[model samples]
Target: MALAVRQACIRAVIDGYQQAAISGLCPEGAFEAAVDAVRMLDMAAVLQREETAACAAGTENIRREPGSVR
Candidate 1:
């Protein structure tokens, strides 16, 4: 998770730098914000998968552990 988060941040920074370079705008916080936005998306997907797995397991009388849920 930490690796993924770091990679996301790096990608965002690169994206922001590219955008700023192309648009002549300051890259300042754009990268950080973009990274945060992407992480939020990733987190959402993980949560959705967990929810789905939980529902499925519950229906079958099986309990899914956190790490193994997805």
Candidate 2:
């Protein structure tokens, strides 16, 4: 699911770049910036997912342990 989201984001950026280029409104270095933005977003998404998973695991462990209080 995360991979799909990342791919979609990249595709959107590419499409935007192409459209901007065709309209002659794409500033120099804008495409690189867009790509960098996508990478940062993807990394953030990954970190969020990892944190969520860790939290879920901790919750489960607490639930399974005897006398563990929330």
- Global lDDT scores for all candidate models: 0.61, 0.66
Q: Cα miss at 70, model 2 (Å)?
A: 48
Question: What would the per-residue lDDT of candidate 2 be over residues 1-70, giving only the tens digit for each residue?
Answer: 4665666687767866676667675566558655655665655666677678778978776545567656
TM-score of model 2 vs. true structure: 0.39
Q: Per-prediction TM-score, please?
A: 0.40, 0.39
**Which pairs clash (backbone N, Cα, C closer than 3 Å) in model 2?**
none
RMSD of each: 8.8, 6.3
| Model 2 CA deviation exceeding 4 Å by range | 29-70
After aligning candidate 2 to the native by TM-score, how far in Å is the CA of 39 from where it should be? 14
| lDDT by residue for model 1 (1-70), tens | 4555465556665765676557665565555555555654555555566667678878888667878864
Top of the candidates by lDDT: 2
Judged by whole-model lDDT over C-alpha atoms, candidate 2 comes out at 0.66
Summed backbone clashes in each candidate are 0, 0
